[model samples]
Target chain A: MALLSLSAVTLTFAGNTVLNEVSFNVAERSVTSLIGPNGAGKTSLFNSITGFYKPQQGSIRFDGTELLKLKPHQVTKAGIARTFQNVRLFREMTVLENVMSGAHCRTSAGAFAAILRTPAQRREEEEIRARARQHLEFVGVWAEQGRIATTLAYGHQRRVEIARALATEPKLLLLDEPAAGLNPTEKHDLVQLIRRIRDEMGIAVLLIEHDMGLVMQISENISVLDHGEIIAEGTPKQIQSDHTVIEAYLGRDDGEAFLDE
Target chain B: MALTDIVLQQLVNGLVLGSFYALVALGYTMVFGVVKLLNFAHGEVYMVGGFAGFIVLSLVSGTLGSGWSGVAVSMVLAMIGVGFLGVLIQKIAYQPMLSAPRLSILITALAVSLVLQNAVLGLTGGRYVPFGADLGFGGVNLGNLFISYNQFILVGTAGVLMLSLELFISRTQYGRAMRAVSIDKDMCRLMGIDVNRVIAVTFFLGSGLAAAAGTMAGAYYGSLWYFMGFLIGLKAFTAAVIGGIGSIPGAMLGGLILGLLESFGTQIPGIGSAWKDVFSFSILILVLVFKPTGLLGRSEQERM
Candidate 1:
């Protein structure tokens, strides 16, 4: 079943249309990779899905509800969580605090109860803290939970960002360039982690990544986009041999030459 | 001057002054911590608080119970009034500039400050207004020294407020929201905290506290002028920077230290009383150069 769907989505900024009539669906508990060159509207699509920008046309439905109508926070409440391409961890905050912030939406204690430190609020806070630590441990950054997030190495910071998103406990996770700045070892480690998270948490993962090898390795389904539109989408093996995809990637290779290979 | 006596006097005086500075500095630090804006109009907000107190006192004296209850009523009413004024300031002046450059907001804050000060001057005809002293109990003697009950309450109240603020930030959900927004506004948005609402609440709380401080100052000193907030605001800001800019406890600690230094400087031989500002500013510069993070702040490591 389609857990997340974007129908005929169109986005324009300053009279320049970035996305035109884009449509797709993310299956339940499946890994889908969005492969595209720069300015292909991958991030813009993510932004639209997360309610950061209202699409000029079309609908984004997640779990049968209109995702476009929800606010950014409401989008998270609707079971969609995401990490940015650039690591956006709260630098001044400790690792634990950063994750707990993601858990903030789940907390019901308001201003007065929190200020008074009521028993119920205290219990909820403790529960959230325990859960946050578990998420950090899941991402393998639990040991560094007490350190300032900014003090961590680049790989660890990315892990913390993922942990923070996990703290939200969403059904769908959106990862934008999670392996961008990582070294070879870190990228390899991230691939394993992504597989583990999908297998263990049973959450649907939609990712945008530049590392072709990483995408080819982990993604169950792949969609290729160029010039703000999807050009090809299929299973890994099918995508590998598609003449159009080859042309798109290698820049207009003769169709007969690619088919022979 | 006798060393022990001078030191004791300055210490007492410093506590009194520090309490007030802490009250004023809390507003500056709170706003700065969350928004990363200096809020140049905060001084004028302090002045508006004093005016609120004066008007309330006048009204209460004519209608309410004879003495302390009237003063108490006036204080509560003044806090609320000042809180409303803060909201208005945010809605009218600061909110519009949220998307503008930091310099533009700073300029707007300065303009608001000027407007408020001038408005007060126009309303009161530029004269210092005296708030009659009818609430406080007479002074009590300790050993060879005498201390006013008002002074003790002032210090105690400020201390309690500061402690309460610390607890609020560290323990409460609203505080967590504020801290979250301060940390990463976009993430806070993703978490469902309306950044605009959080910022508004910040302005309200900070301004309310400043109002409380202004009221206490008016009642304790028995007189106020339109320009009173300017000097106190400058001193409080200095205190805020001397401590780390976003560190809450640091502001309180800085306020107390600055107050003590200024008081002691007045007692120094050959320095005379006129150089108190000089002495205070000198310490500020030294702290900025030597310990930029102030007394309580721990340095944050950079992330690539």
Candidate 2:
């Protein structure tokens, strides 16, 4: 069974249809890239899956449980975590605080216990902190943990955002333009990080990226979107060779220019 | 009163007044820390606390002894009661507007404030009633320095509560979560925190503290009215701003400073006593122009 499956998912924002009968499945421990042009509603679909935007019509099932009825935090508790297209970190807090916050949902300590610092709460906090630090190390920002998140370099902030998301201990991780503003070297590092997160952590990775190079390099399978519909779906090599996919990318003048480049 | 006596008395009075300001200011700071908006109705919540204390004290007068224990019962009951009211306000007034404009929430806060105040006015006939002066414990007498028990309790309670709050924020996971949410709501949500719950918790704690101040005010000074929250609320708010808006310790330091300023402000021969508010607000303007971060706040860079 798919780890996360969206069935005929449709989203309309204020009468403007953003996702029209979009459907896909993210298999466990696999990397699936959702690629689309700027207006193709990639983020909208991600939002729908993550429970940020309730779809007008469709069903999102995670590990066989209906996801639409659950709140965003409940979905997180169900082990689905996501990053935003625009990075959102608790900028004023230290890197460690930002990442540890992701562990909040899974934390077993009740408010009273956490407030009173019972032995159990202390042990749980210690475990969560250790896990948070490990995630930071995994993302290569552990050394920068003391720094305020906003003060970090762009690439480091990106790493921190991913680390924060990873702290949730999700079974399926959604990456929204994770490599958008990275340099080539940072992109290579992020690609490695994504793969390690998948292979070592045994988590399925669902990514939405405009960077075709990064997407093709890391994704096990690819789905192309245009005008809120799935235009193409196949393995990376198949997606790279499809005629309609080529037309979707190169038929428009901008697409042709992109192809030329 | 002689100049020395008037000066000394106002200094004493202002410090006592500042304790109330500091107590109420903490709530505003905590709420603003997490939500980034002043809980405009916080003052009304403070008033509600006073009423809760009044009602509880009336009920417990004969059953509880008339000394410190009675007062203690009243304080605890008042805090719990007003804290509940705070939670209700969050659920009814602020929650719906969480995603709305900051201005809308602020207006809703003002509306709640108005509604509570008028409701009290309707019940109490807009008159000030004296509370039990017996809540005042005996005073320590220094030669010419007359310190009342009420003053001691007011300042001491505020101090202990503040220290506890500091320890709570620095040492606990919920505190850490609050700090995180204050810094970034979306990040907190993504972290698996129920952002709404954190927001509610913030209001509960903050309003609870404000209730403590309200009860102390009624007990220490012996009278309270429906509009009692307005001036006090403004001063506490000013204190919050004078300290960095969201910083906890900053609010305490700012409250004490404002107290001292008001205490000393009237002493200037020409400046006179009436200019206390003018002086306090002037300091706010100066701080805004110069540091902008207030006394302890660090300047934050914009996140793109």
Question: lDDT (0-100) at residue A153 of candidate 2?
Answer: 94
DockQ of each: 0.52, 0.57
lDDT per residue as tens, model 2, B86-203:
9898899888888898899999988999999999999999999766636645787655667787777778888888887787687666888899888777656667889888887788
Candidate 2 ranges with C-alpha deviation above 4 Å:
A114-119, A252-261, B1-14, B61-64, B141-144, B271-275, B285-293, B297-304
- Cα lDDT of model 1 overall? 0.83
A76-122 in candidate 1: lDDT tens per residue?
A: 98888999888888767789988888887777886557656789888
- lDDT by residue (A44-138, candidate 2, tens digit) is 88777777888978899999899988878888889988887777887667899888888889887776676456899888878888998999999
TM-scores for all predictions: 0.89, 0.91
Interface RMSD of candidate 2? 1.4
Q: Which 10 residues in a row give candidate 1 chain B its minimum summed lDDT? A: B295-304
**How accurate locally is residue B99 in candidate 2, as Cα lDDT from 0 to 100?**
84
The C-alpha lDDT values of all candidates are 0.83, 0.83
| RMSD to true structure for each model, in Å | 3.6, 2.9
Looking at model 1, the pairs that clash are: none
RMSD of 2: 2.9
